[model samples]
Target: MDTLSALISHAEPKANLFFSGNLCGSSSSTDHPAGGILHLVRTGEMLLFEEYGLTHRITEPTLIIYPKGKAHRLQPQTLDGCDVVCANLTFKDSPLYRALPDAIVLPLNELDNLSDTINMLFIEAFTSRFAQVAIISTLLDLLLLLVLRHLVENRICQEGVLSALSDHKLSKAIEIIHKQIDYPWSIDELANKVGMSRARFAALFNQTIGQPPLSYVTEARLLLAKKLLLKGEPIKSVSLEVGYSGSVAFSRAFQRQFGITPRAWYLKQH
Candidate 1:
């Protein structure tokens, strides 16, 4: 897969719709974490105040995503009509998170491409009919994908994994590393694959990705190892699968990276 697809594959993002209701008076929401908060305004209007004292007025049929999870307050404009659906989004930790903004607001006009999905979400949320939960959950997932796509297409994310993928040379190198995590990758090999001199490639890769190329390879390997361990694979098997020759070497490297031996980490997770 390409770099963007590979990064997204590792992220394993998911969305959960937790609350849906109407508010008549002013109120504030509880502080959330970096995982993200999504708000779909179905009717009336509300004001969102950020921690920095900035405020945004959201009218009906608008979607707002707070990717940074800043603490904020939401108050209705009046005492009669503000309906909303709120959801929490969770995704695997990655540097890509840094590329996103504090919040992304898509008004009704901007959502023309997603009109059908947005409409379906509102319908499923308000009707509470058969399979409403499943339908809403699916729609929320679609909405999250839409938002990420918008960010990429608009070039709104200028750093982190997304930015690296936007570069031709770095993306090719990244794709190779992701596709061949088990291969013993050297800086020379990665640079050669991308048709660049080793020094030039190393410098550019570090500048674009904020880390050395081999460091990314190691991270990718460890991520794969973690997945294998979680699936009950043997330590030795995971070691070789991720390029380490033996369990002892793998255990040491894993411990250095995560501050715990693989076995201990697996047991705690289980």
Candidate 2:
């Protein structure tokens, strides 16, 4: 059988599911599509963690997600039977999922634990025999949001500057920087704002996030600048808002990251 299998019971004119089926394998070979995986533990438990790496498990009465596309193991944790419902989803051109980090996990021991709306999606798909693609698509969106929310609430991120923002001191510091991208934020001052000694705060943040605090803020500001520029906002406006003195600095940063000038990107994007 293929790595992925989907069947919609209903075929409505306005499709409700993009694709639905089972995704299982003897092993997590590279054969699976490079996308997200949503899995529900139907019976026995599954231990899904990696050694000295990023991983989480799906015990009974649990819901687990593989957002970063990480390779992990799954099998019956008990003898009852390891039944699972798995979905391999891809949100091509969806900005929301694109903005998310690699992986997120949520726990659900009961079917009712999931959003009622989301559960209804499967119910309709399984019960109906028409085009349910529309419903499934929307349900998948909610699923993606919940997955990201899991990461956000837990503050576990495999990608994005949010990794740095996960720090309490740095999160606060980053908040201030975001609020005042126009203001020059010093690491010493930010540390003081968060009630940590400059040396201690900097060290802790660097150790936790693998980058200098100031660099983190700079990159975040540049990202904000890019967002604004993408919206066709004036370069000067973006620079001033993101803490740059003017368009020159912001444009330079944008160019450095995209290998294209902000204006060029804006024109092409628009």
Candidate 3:
């Protein structure tokens, strides 16, 4: 994959990873929730199926990303009890996840070694505040690393220009955009960072990501602006925080992105 697409997965100003697990359930259980699910069965097995046929049989380290909030099960072959470690997770609403499929399973790859990092999420969710949120926060980082490795190692879908975001150069640009959300950026700079010419970067980035480099930069910045605004920053401050030369430019961009003016958005907050 290209750089930018790869970079998007790691892009932060991301959602808090609120759950992880060391759960082992041998009994069949059904779940229907807005939250998504991921499962890894080490010993026995798991069957993930809907009303009719089978969706998946988990005998290995199976990774499922359920987006439709559909009903599914986790258990052994007989539709009865089985051993499984499952994770129920949710993320703060963000634009990036909009690109993922409702569900996909990938090989565990090399990420299994980092299982402890993932296990900590379960600890954080169920445990008291004895340690610190920092531990859970770090777990999220590592969890992201695993998901990223899985997505990269085994990409199921083969559609959409956005999938090209998995490309290396483009992913690099995305990472830069995310890491430096507060800095004003130019396509030329992003292009250079990814070792491409301005025109080349624009065309390739646009083709793969379904948006031009400028739009992406603006989108990334405005997303950050909204986050800052949500944190109670003033309009002018939010504008500057996201790299606008002035609040007016930022306002226009923000309106273009979210369908309302910054002042209106801020007022709604108060």
Output the number of the lDDT-best candidate: 1
Instruction: List the candidates ranked by TM-score, beginning with the highest.
Output: 1, 3, 2
Candidate 2 segments exceeding 4 Å error: 1-17, 21-118, 128-139, 152-167, 257-259, 266-270
Cα lDDT of model 2 by residue, 1-270, tens digit: 110000000101111232233324333514455566666554555566543543655654456665546665554445554655566655422223333555545555333435575566556545655656655666656655554444554566654434544556656765665556567889888888889999998887777656777876666666556666656788888788878777888788778766898788778876
Query: In candidate 1, which residue pairs clash?
Result: none
**lDDT of candidate 3 vs native?**
0.61
**Candidate 1 lDDT, 1-270, residue by residue in tens:** 666667667666678987788967655446443457888888987888878774788766688887656677788887776888888877665445545676777786776778888888888888869888988999999888877776766666776656676678888988898778899999999998999999999999888777888887887788778878887999999999989989999999999888999999999997
Candidate 3 Cα outliers beyond 4 Å, as residue runs? 1-33, 50-53, 67-76, 93-96, 107-141, 153-168, 182-184, 263-270
Give Cα-based local distance difference scores for all models: 0.79, 0.56, 0.61
- How would you encode candidate 3's per-residue C-alpha lDDT over 70-157 as one tens digit per residue? 4666546543344333445554334455555676665455456656764556556556786556766666556655575555455543
Task: Indicate whether candidate 2 or candidate 3 has the larger lDDT.
Answer: 3
Model 1 lDDT-worst window of ten: 26-35
Higher lDDT: candidate 1 or 2? 1
